[model samples]
Each structure stands twice: as structure tokens, then as C-alpha cells.
Target: MTIIETAKMNGVDPLAYLADVLDRNHDHNISRLDELLPWIGHPLP
Candidate 1:
């Protein structure tokens, strides 16, 4: 199921649920790279 559907089934706000998931599992290296790519003018492959 899609994220919004899963969130509704679990009775949580979708955006909040997504944020929580990201907070719990996201890698800071990837996050920093994601933010930096645009500033570096290099598209990620």
C-alpha cells in the first residue's frame, strides 16, 4: 500500500509518519549529499 494509505490505516498523520520513518532510519550522509548536490551543480546518477 501507498504511504498515505498505510498512515490512514494506522491512524497517524501521513506527513508525520513519513517524517518519523525518515528520522528513525535516514542516513545523515545521504541526507547531506542530497542537500549538497544542488549547490554543487552536479546531478546525482
Candidate 2:
């Protein structure tokens, strides 16, 4: 719920946000996790 709400607050599609984050998370650097936040506007690869 928090993820959905935060995405909405940032004007991002919640489903897209979650899907992208989950897909990237497997290979993303944990130390730079903030880059995955909805507000960061990380483009889907």
C-alpha cells in the first residue's frame, strides 16, 4: 500500500513502478537503492 501511495504521490503508475523496480532489483546495487524510489524517475530499461 505504501508503494502504491508513494508512486501515486509522484505521479507514476503504481503497477509500472512496482514491475520495473522488481525487475531491476535482482541486478541493482543494494547500496544505491534510493535510485529505485518512485520519485527518482528511474527509466525502465
> Model 1: per-residue lDDT, tens digit, 1-45?
476785567556666655655664455575454433222332222
The residue pairs found clashing in candidate 1 are none
Tens-digit lDDT track of model 2 for 1-45: 999999999999999999899988899988999999999989954
Worst 10 residues of 1 by lDDT: 36-45
lDDT of each: 0.50, 0.91
TM-scores, all candidates, are: 0.48, 0.91
Q: For this target, which candidate reaches the highest TM-score against the unseen true structure?
A: 2
Show pairs that collide, candidate 2: none
